[model samples]
Target: MSRKRLLPALALLAFVAGCGANAAADDSAKLSLDAPLPTAVPDGAKIVVGDPATEVALKLSGQYDKVSKYVQFANLSGGPQTTEAFRAHALDLGSVAEIPPIHATWTGLHVKIVASKFRQDPLNHPIYKLGVAPGVSVKTFGDLRGKKIAYSPGQAQGALILKVLKKAGLTKDDVKLVELPSTGDVYAQALAGKQVDVAPIGGVQIKRYLAKYGKDGASTIDHGLRDDAGHLYGPVESLEDPAKAAAIRAYVAAWGVAQEWIDKHPKEWIEGYYVKNQGLSAADGQWLVDNAGHPDIPADWSDAIQRQQETIELLAQETGNKVIEAKDLYDLRFQTVAADAIKGGAK
Candidate 1:
């Protein structure tokens, strides 16, 4: 919730769940920034939004101010807050993990994915480890049949847990889902306090726990549960307006710049955000710099959208049968713009 903050105070947990942008004329041009605005453009960019982990890059690069001149961005907390913003039509441009947009679509919210990228790297997969309580014996998803899980409904972790359940031939009814406060170190605290059987954690939380408890004290279950993508979205109403639409396009292009910047300057990013902002150690910062690759803002959705649709469908199985197709959720107008801005392609 704090502006430009990386992960929360709890190091390891924040590392796992920390949320994450910018602009230029040539970059904006790729997104049709030069398009003539409608005579009656909106007065201000008063949309509530999320942090999305890009605030640092956008600020450091000085692109945030350039884009904000046209599009007013109001920052919210993270995934849970952004989900509510979408539900209430309180946000124009927002960022969230995969599940929020799917929920919006099912609720008939006119939101579309403007940009997206897979969160995992094949070589350096994110450390979303499933750590069980000291006394519990949940070694795999199948072992979660009667266990209590730390879950935040409609968030990325919940969606992931559902996928693991499905793969293990288990259902939601087979386990006990516990809701934990998203603020601070709730996930780590819950696990340490023996409140939940299995807690999916990362970064500082994992480091601290493993150091104090050791592998024998706190067991981890690695089910190869990785590969999730984050999305930047906006309401259709704003996208239909000429002025806001231009701003949105410009933002998309600037966003690509910010994403590239993070990947290119991982060391600066770690120091500025992970170490300085999130209170992580030099070692923790270096780990993130080495592992958390820059996000991929896909220029083409043919393959990515299909993967997203499949992910949504898998989660929907737990939320009832209201189906949401890829066509209903994505606005691909900016794909070319993203392609123009990103140098190495959207991988």
Candidate 2:
């Protein structure tokens, strides 16, 4: 069926199911940063791997239905709005890959780690690379010294570059990092013209420029990028996990379904969610839909928790703030569903 038709049915289902949320309940959400969102944590929910609740509300970063397909997972508008909701507790479940939630833990927010969305290599995402014009001879991370790198500030991918650079024996001091605002396209355009030595590309844009696009536009200076896995694992934090583990399973299950859908019907997925909804070109959207990490969500919450802790520690160091422990921020009890559902396949 066409997505246009599917959406109406989904919208009707959501309305019938009464799953939508009132954005008005979150007037303060607009002003504050995202805190841990509150969720209906059912008591004594069995720790069945991979079975998080299906009907819970969520505060997703970008529009998720473009990928997930299920309707009415009430959330903040998109990235910026959802982020603020996480800060304000206007949401019960929120997803972010880095920085925001890491900082939230320090303030003693109600957020807790329930589950994770693992990307094979975050650096490979167009959102995370340094794109150079064809004229630039910068092919490796070593060439970034004294070159201008433009990107959004404090984002996980940006910080990841710094982290990896430090591992590579460099730091922010090695390059001139230019902070851009909403118009990262302007930044990319700047890179294409060599105005900026390197314009950081995130998500599949990195893939597009590196593998698909012609050299006439842009190319990756793959020096600092770690193929460690080109995908990223976004942490889903929530407050009140009465079902704790079970809730996670449901989410993961649905995620798998959504991923399978993307694979089986790539064109529909791109058209319905990416090109039209996200306002990107078909090529850009296709790059995203095709390349997204479809690995099964890890049932072993410990690995994700540890990674989050590392991210938090990094955040603390960056901000010079008091420390926040992984144990304190992660509410394992809420992920009973995820614990119950995972069955060993993660790419």
- Largest lDDT belongs to which candidate? 1
Native-vs-model 1 lDDT? 0.65
Let me know the TM-score candidate 2 reaches against the reference structure.
0.63
* Candidate 2 C-alpha lDDT tens digits along 246-336: 2343454444444434455667666665665667788887777655644445545676667667766765665687767776655454344
User: What tens digits encode model 1's per-residue C-alpha lDDT throughout 1-347?
Assistant: 54234222223222322221111212333233234433333555333245546666677666677655654445454565555554444556777667777777666666777787665463356646777888787765678889898887667777777777877998878988898754566777788788998877765676676676565567777657555576788766656555556666666677777788777877777777787777888898887666565565656788877877788778767777576787668776766565566664321
- TM-score, per-candidate, Cα-based: 0.79, 0.63
Task: Please give the distance, in angstroms, between residue 309's alpha carbon in candidate 1 and its true position after superposition.
Answer: 1.9
Regions more than 4 Å wrong, model 1: 1-49, 87-89, 120-124, 344-347
lDDT of each: 0.65, 0.48
